[model samples]
Target: MGTSTRQLNIGFIGFGSFAQFLAKTMTKQGHLIRATSRSDYSAHLGDNFIRDMDEFMGLEHDVILICTSIVSVSEVVKSIPFHCLKKPTLFADVLSVKEHPRQLLLQEVPEDSDLVCTHPMFGPESGKDGWKGLNFMYERVRVRDEDICSSFLNIFEYEGCKMIEMTCEEHDRLAAQSQFVTHTIGRILSEMQLTNTQINTKGFEKLIQVKESAAKDSFDLYSGLFIHNRFAKQQMKNLESALERVKGLLEAKM
Candidate 1:
């Protein structure tokens, strides 16, 4: 099955900023999009927006993409009327943390429904120009329908994203070290209210960029990075210990 030829019916579970960003590209590729969220997006999504959860689940969709926040995954997944589903659909999530959704969907979604846990490392800000070379990690936890899953994944591949297949645990462990640490540092920089100077070095300029980027995202997202990923706590400790070590070294030199 050629991805270019197949037009998929992709339904979004949450139509927030991120989901809307993804929908733009999917729509451009000629895929049909239907969305249902806590907030009404009728103006943005037009007639495609279904406000009722049951009715939304009743639709025939190739993929039901979960776009809720990391903190709300449990509440949202529990509320979904899986019994209302017309058929066994491909259930995938675009959450930052993988293992949470991977486990939740496996437990909540219908036994026949396929599950794919994915995290598109780049968001709207980063991928605004294009998704070329952006990292997209995914774990096919319980996928049985290969064609639909492949076609869905092809959306990223079509945009030149660097796709990586990894286990949920591995992704969480690595993300805590890399992404969580980056966000943590960025938030700290933001708290300091750092600004550029006329004699700013390239490194300082980069730090300012990180601060600005982190400030743009909601604090809920930052907190979720810490709260959801088990490995994040250790990363936080590591960051603190490293800072203390650097301070001790400077004091000893004095």
Candidate 2:
């Protein structure tokens, strides 16, 4: 609600859960958003959804944020014809890593536009607490455009969230560590079921409790951090090596 209704026409390319949440939050700040979806979505902005690229022509959108998955993001960018993006649009995405999204920013977006690459690090369960935990970036963007990033920062900080910023290269390298490790742990924890309700200690129980609560989030989303992220493959390798060492230690004890 910090921004006035000057109505910045924001366009979102995907209409999934994360995309829906982001659009709802942005709309609350008085942004005039137009969204596109391949599937039926329930947003108030659903009228903006364009199924065919041919229908999206002549759209005077200011900022276009793509919230699609790593698998579909490439095709979305490839479909944007160069001549159609002449309005200096600002582009961003909430994809887990910068590999594909960054490639689109460089190769697909109109050359003259100010490009912003974002990664919303939180999920649907976050609710009002979401943006606080969201790690994002504004690539090659004019530092003076504080309205967009700062507004979001204020919203998050008010909710006890730390907003972190870094270049796409740094973000990807670090996410390989932060996200990959966390998801691997969450995945392992989620797959196990503890039948002894009273026998489980407080620490062990709470860790599983956290995982159970987080289980409400889409594992498919977490899978992106572990799978599509090119830089994270090495982190997985290192983890496997550490596990091998641990196995040897346990065998020695046996």
Candidate 3:
């Protein structure tokens, strides 16, 4: 990551593992980080954890980032006290599915607040070393305060992320074919209980990595990709058809 260009007072809506992972980098970049969640994260966050939702909203924040799980986003967003916001802030999300959070933020956030729907494709595991070359997709759904919005975006850019500017609908469509499919295959491999043997091929080793990576994340995240993204169902069908086609070709030879 490059030198921090602009410092932002960023507040988080959820302080889960992903959120905490992001907080470490943001703090390293010299941005002020404060957070509020359903549970107390004082042990993890120290004084940065705010237990009261209303007080968290009332604080001065240039950006309020929603880092909750995809399944919990709707309920969490609906419960936010937007009335408590002291000033117009830039509201962004780090959900894997874009369109879902995009529509919800647009509907729920205050009219004065700006909205930027984003999905940083890499997770803590993928980005543990650095964010260089990792994809960071974003859509500026609503933005009146361009400076604050740009500052928030610069955080990712400074980290050498391959910035991708696209619409929410387009993101979901492409992600279903790419990310969701990868996760599905990884989960399938994990279910098969495959393990490394004394004589493992290079290809088998790679498959083991995929299985391990998918197993690290919660099932809720995997399910949310299917349930929230409209295009995911079709991708699932494609995977099943491909498997059957390959099976048929082998059977014909036999």
Candidate 4:
């Protein structure tokens, strides 16, 4: 789908680290933003903050971005007062896993409202510099008013993100092999307590980086990747089987 550059009033459902990171860029791009979360982030958002969910729905934003954790996405989406929405709005998500949110939004959101499931594929630490060359994957689950969806997506497209359009199923399968595997390795490194050494190899340093980055994120994020993505379970099994094969090879050599 084609998109045009247009300023949008975007409302974030959750104002955590990831949401804040995205808000910075959207604000820089001159999109009006408002947010409400379980905790009070009024100070952070200033006049844009709406304390009440009912009032938040009344704001009539062109897009409502779901920035909640993957595990809580269902509860969060269900809690939204869709009937209170002033108009048909575009509902988008930035969860790491795609299929879950795509399904939840499809089930929970009103039929008239549009749905776009997206994963930014970078976080606060990684995208701190800029979104240039970073991958942004999305699937247009349901869309009738295409212009609003395109305009909202343009925010990322304009920021030098490599916009990738694919089915949610395809995204989950690929992410299981790539993102899930990376996190699993990072968690394993963390478990091993891998640390810096005077003679750190280039490969070891990269592992350290992964371990640190992954450790910084909540276990909830990692768990959600495994629990929500069907393909991730197989990847986990593959990881264990690969290690076992390696162990058997070492034993044979011994």
The candidate that achieves the highest TM-score relative to the unseen native structure: 1
Count backbone clashes in candidate 1: 0
**Which pairs clash inside model 4?**
none
- Write model 3 residue lDDT over 1-254, tens digit each, in one string: 54456889999999999999999999999999999999899998788899999999999999999999999999999999999999999999999999999999989999999999998988888899999999999999999999898889889989999999999999999999998998999999998999999999999999999898888889999999999999999999999999999999999999
**Residue-level lDDT tens digits of model 2 in 82-182:** 57654566676778877657876677666666566666667676565545444444344433355644543444354444556677778888888986777
1-254, model 1: which lDDT tens digit per residue?
22363789999999999999999999999999999999999999889999999999999999999999989989999999998999999999999998888889989999999999999999888999989899999999888999999999999988888999999999999999998998999999988989999999999999999898888899999899899999999999999999999999999999
TM-score of each: 0.97, 0.81, 0.96, 0.97
Q: Choose 2 or 3, whichever is better by TM-score.
A: 3
Off by over 4 Å in 3: 1-3
Greater-lDDT candidate between 1 and 4: 1
Superposition error at 175 for model 4 (Å): 0.7
Which 10-residue span in candidate 4 carries the lowest summed lDDT?
1-10
Better of 1 and 2 by lDDT: 1
Worst 10 residues of 2 by lDDT: 135-144
For model 3, the local distance difference test gives 0.94
Q: Count the backbone clashes (under 3 Å) in each candidate.
A: 0, 0, 0, 0
| Order of candidate numbers by TM-score, starting with the best | 1, 4, 3, 2
User: After superposing candidate 2, which stretches have Cα over 4 Å from the reference?
Assistant: 1-6, 129-138, 141-161, 194-196, 217-220
- The collision pairs in model 1 are none
- Give the clash total for candidate 2: 0
TM-score of 2: 0.81
Best by lDDT: 3
